[model samples]
Target: MRSRLLRTARCLGRDYTKPSAQALRCSGARWQSTSGREWSTPLAKTLAEAISVTGPLPVAAYMRQCLTSDLGGYYTSHNEGRDVFGQKGDFITSPEISQVFGELVGLWVVAEWMAQGRKSEGVYLMEVGPGRGTLMDDMLRTIRNFPALASSLEAVYLVEASPSLREAQHKLLCGDKPIEEIDIGHQSYSKYADNLKVIWTEDVRFVARDPAKTPFIIAHEFFDALPIHIFQSVPPSQPSAPSEITTPTGKHTLNETARLPRASQTNSWRELLVSPTPPYSNHASLGTPKSQQSSGPPPEFELTVAKASTPHSLYLPETSQRYKALKNSDHAVIEISPESQAYAADFAVRIGGGTAPTPTPSLAATSSSTTTTTTQARPVSSSKPEPVHKPTPSGAALILDYGPPSTIPTNSLRGIKQHRMVSPLSEPGLVDLSADVDFMSLAETAINASEGVEVHGPVEQALFLNAMGIKERAAQLVKRALDRERGASLEKSEGERRKEDLTETVKRIETGWKRLVDRGPQGMGKLYQVMAIVPHVPPKEGEKRRRPVGFGGDIVV
Candidate 1:
């Protein structure tokens, strides 16, 4: 059944074995010769050459190369010192929009820590995709206010891949402090906290999981950036063959008769791959919308259905029941991100104990008693040691990103360049690519990966923030600004200028927070969502389970 489903699915529209001359021409037309064409970027040319040599590339492969390829990847490229964040870059993030966003996030972490018994030691703060380190810096500053919780923090871990972004984060989090090479990536002391060491690793897996410690993980707008494999369901074609037939005159003659598609045939999933558009293809040829067409140029790459079943098309969509349910629908399209699921699983395993091996062998083999410390340049760093036994699960992870609350993401791939939305296939490495996250898949993976974890609230960002008290926080900041203005003394004209400046300052603050919690059609609050994973508790017969603060329940401690 599996073989029949996958094999027939790949032959949709036409047979793969014996293609007619017209089919061959159509194939050639789709991916024209690159001889006379000039690509916009070096990476685009490289991608074209590679695709020419080796059939079309998977969307995941294209995204991975465009995003993190060593030479010209959007994030990894040091050429021209590309900046992918902030108003000057492709797009801005929540933390960059307002300080209140980060402050509330920090407060949520502290509140959770206190609710979960406030362990005196063995607590770590980790952030994945810590762009510019602005969120972490804001979070650390807020956490410092709670002496008990702040002192319990042993270390800070930042999972980042880009060298330029890492340096930017280092400069922001740890002013002029020297950063030294560590076994995993690099380590530096954060300027925001007292002797708090910050470690940067390219991947989260590099950090050894010690069930003894509690890790508060933050992934803000991270999952959306992960590469996604897109698949579409189409009616499968029946196998065809040239069968012999007898002529009407009773003479034996050869006839090309194909088998009819069976009524039992159902739609099957086919993976979409990325290939260079036909040479000099215009906006009309590419079928780009008039509203999306820019003065620049038509997209260089386009998504094409694979001619035959690829490994991903055969395997990925079948991995989940959610995808399986939609496989029979001819128009169903789904985007799956294995990287995002893996990261979510890792988060679950770290917070709620797991049996998975350490990412590195040497680290795995290191005895539980083994420990290491940073260089003696500054205050003593936290001791991170592998554990032999899985301790009681504790800690929490907060994921905030844009997507539907409980559905699989479809047709959500998009590109942003200088704030305007563009075709994702336009310019390789030059434009930023992102897709809506599959929150349901993430929750499923997290729960399946760890026995000690429970999931909560794939809720709207507005609901979460309102519950977290964004309005109250914004109000306090406004009051403080007004008080400062009232205490100022100057000449009449000077006072007038100061008053106007203060009024604008107050207005900006109000606007920023409102933008975050706004529920309008284009607002961030409605578009984005928040999810949390924490240690699970066995329910007693008569008592209700405790809920996290931002989700529904109040802080216990």
Candidate 2:
């Protein structure tokens, strides 16, 4: 039997950017080369070269290649030299649609900050997917009203994964600086920084800024853009089947295969996930199966999908919720991104209180400790936090995306080109490829990431926005409009005339607000969702649950 995987990276040749004929053959049928115009996309060529060298690529790998590839990745090439998120872009986010969205979010952060009594250590104001910085700008402007809260902010950070987006963010946030002078924060000025304080990076993994400072993270329409791995659940092997192979020399060899993908239900295509690693002898795969073995429960297997290059799957404990949670049908698919999970873990660690078991024991001990626990108790930042400390760095993260609370995404993967939906594989890096964020996994990751981390409602965007007071904000704007539109008409019916004059402006304001908060198809208020994680400090006497503002509202709207 041949080696299941030939481990052929070097066979690709000295130049990894260009695909070689020998490497193309190594990629098998999934990646084919052609000297035609169809293969003109720089991203496609590079991806082909990558696959040729690496063999079949995982869904996440393919997505990363297409989205962030330095050569011609869609986002890397600066949104493919096209506008990607406005009336003129591929799609528009809520922030770009209206200022109300940002204002409310800003207010929410303020409420949370004040509720915590303004940490002396302060907090890092951060936003994931800042987009042209419109959301953050609006948020900053709104927060500036509370000078103390604004002052409490140590710094602002933007978790951007695209070079093009980072450049755009600098231009949008830095105001009048020349492109040369404003290259992602070469110089740091505090005054100019109140507006341009945000630091940009192509990686979200390091955006926590400082582990010592609590992070007020706003992830609007962010997680959905992260890459996910697609997995197809394989049925249990037969009672007396030979899932393993034995060679003629009496040496047992395991079967190993690289990334594989298949078309599935509409808008979804299943990709290679964890497959059971067959018993192997030396370094070769034995095609012969040992069917004459004893009959017992078949060997169990778990997915090794976190990394793209994992050659075989292994048995996971029954406690593993991922593979266990897959639907009964063979068509059921589970998408997981190790990067997302890792991001969650890193965030959780920075967040201070992770769900790790030791914290619970520590908590039990703290409740019985001699020192007063004060308003809130937080875990120390270091691996070994000082024994008696109060106000552990509490961080709160709000994730907003067009994803449901559910983990299983049957067909959430697709492409959007100029607002028109297109096949994900159609143009490769030419289009933006995204899938719904698995908030369930994210929540779990948060819980498992660190001690003291708590998860909150993965509520509807409509409810979240409404709770944030979009309606009140809209009304105030309308009232302002009425004043601006009211002319010097003096008759008794002048009031009616003024009202009539203001109707269009009120309607305009209402329309944009509706688009942000409405539950219907045209509105993003429902399809999009909001979830948050913060330190769970037990409420004091008369205090109720301490959820973020987006989870509930005092106002009817």
Candidate 3:
């Protein structure tokens, strides 16, 4: 770890000493944005002093500043909505591409509400981190299809933390109906002082309302932005353990060898010790209850034992060589996101009900089979047990991100700048860094927190959209485009001359949508996944969620 850090420092030093063309371009862009003012203002001097004193800040910190800095953060100083679209933006989100994404999402929530028996009388249609309100507009437009749903929607709660983005969202969502704001503690709907039927805020930490009464939620492309902590495994003998100690005889030995039994000869015995510390520790303090700290390691660390071998038996003469070979060979890669789990757990508590064991503890325990022996044997504590799960209002929650059901050997952390891939370690906060989410772990965490909080996906985005009928919708759009093109061609008496142009345009749109759903090489099919969670019973015996025709088993939930 020290060596890696040193190497990184050296590389950074070299890069700084000889700024590349890219850095020059970035500096030129910033200079142009700041007008003719010199770069060395008192504020700039203070920032430089802070950086010099603190060494290098984490990429997450830099990103937070860049995106939300009071005076110069990307969102604060510029019109991000306008800047973050088309060929000029860093990257275009699905909602920015088409209204279909948000419309289908709104419909999905309605389906979830119906599935839960539509019990909530005044449900809140909430969106966390609504980007530019494009989603909200499309969703409300679609909700009008079901007038009852549109009317029942007590409020459109948007939880956004950025003032600039919030203003943008507000502008996009402006309508005759009132809009409300709900702070963490003062959550009454009357705060808006109008006929406000909806609200919006970003991040769950700020919501201050009874989740049970308004159990509908939406989070599109929100989880991906949450900071992630990453750690690479260093061999136990690699001198990276925190508890390093020198032997009394003046000899140094790996900490694991001294602490763990020497008889454990298998290289598989090694486990990467990583903690989901700050930036990744969900919006709660680390000192919170185990349930509240759901985004960290499960209370206990698990260790698996490998098969033992005889000390001197020459079962295999090439033992050391073979051991070395096997040691380098990648086995299982464990990727964990305590943040995602914490969020899911919180969602479960909100929708399913306070971590209370539903009336029939024994029956419910038996049915869910989630209660531990200790929890089953002990009498339920009377004192409202510190909420095991972080609290949130009731609502359907959707997590869409990149990742697979099982772990992969290679790390997924990568950087993106101007829609191009770059090294995560190269430019730090100047680029976006992300890792694939472990949806399976997230589902387990949510279910364990509260029963009947159904976690239905880690489904491929392509499949989810197809299940929601994106393909047919895209085809209709393409047909309309073709028709328009054909009319233009006929008017110009260039029917045959413009045939190729029309075909190419139609192909691009069709191909783009296909790429959006594509999974393998040359497609985003497998790269992005969409997941849905709702308060409801699991599908009945042998029954599965209805998927769109032709998508088949690809849509895993």
Best by TM-score: 1
Comparing 2 and 3 by lDDT, which wins?
2
Against the reference, the lDDT scores of all candidates come to 0.77, 0.57, 0.50
Q: Assess every candidate by TM-score.
A: 0.84, 0.70, 0.61
Tens digits of per-residue lDDT for model 3, 250-356: 75655565665444324332322212222222343221233324453321111122222222121211222322344434452333343455566666776765563
RMSD of 3: 14.8
Q: Write the per-residue lDDT of candidate 1 for residues 1-557, one digit (tens) a residue.
A: 34543443332211123212221111112332347676666567667766665567777767766776543567766655457788888899889988999999999999999988998899999998899999999999899999999889989999887768889999999999999998777999978675788999765656768878899999999889887889998777756544555677764544323344443256778888888888666653232334577666568888888766777788889989999999988868999987787778788889887643332212211111101122113232234433334467799999999999888998888888899878888677777889999999989988987888999978889999999999999999999998988888889999999989998988988998999988998678899999999989886999899888889979886
- Badly placed stretches (over 4 Å) of model 1 are 1-34, 239-264, 283-290, 293-297, 356-391
lDDT of 2 by residue, 1-557 (tens): 01212322232221123222221111112322343322436445544444544555555555555565444556655323466778787888888878888888888887777766677555778776688788887888888887777767777777665546766676766665643323332223233344335565333423433546778888887667666666655443223335456678775644332111222211222355322223231221111113312332222111233332142222221124765655345546666655555556556666764333222112221111111121023222425432212247476777888776865564566667788765565446667878888788778878776656678878998888877778889989987886776645567687777777778767878888899877888778788878888776777999876666778634211
Whole-model alpha-carbon lDDT for candidate 1? 0.77
Ranking by lDDT: 1, 2, 3
- Ranking of all candidate structures by their TM-score, best first: 1, 2, 3
Candidate 3 clash figure, as a count: 28
State each candidate's clash count: 0, 12, 28
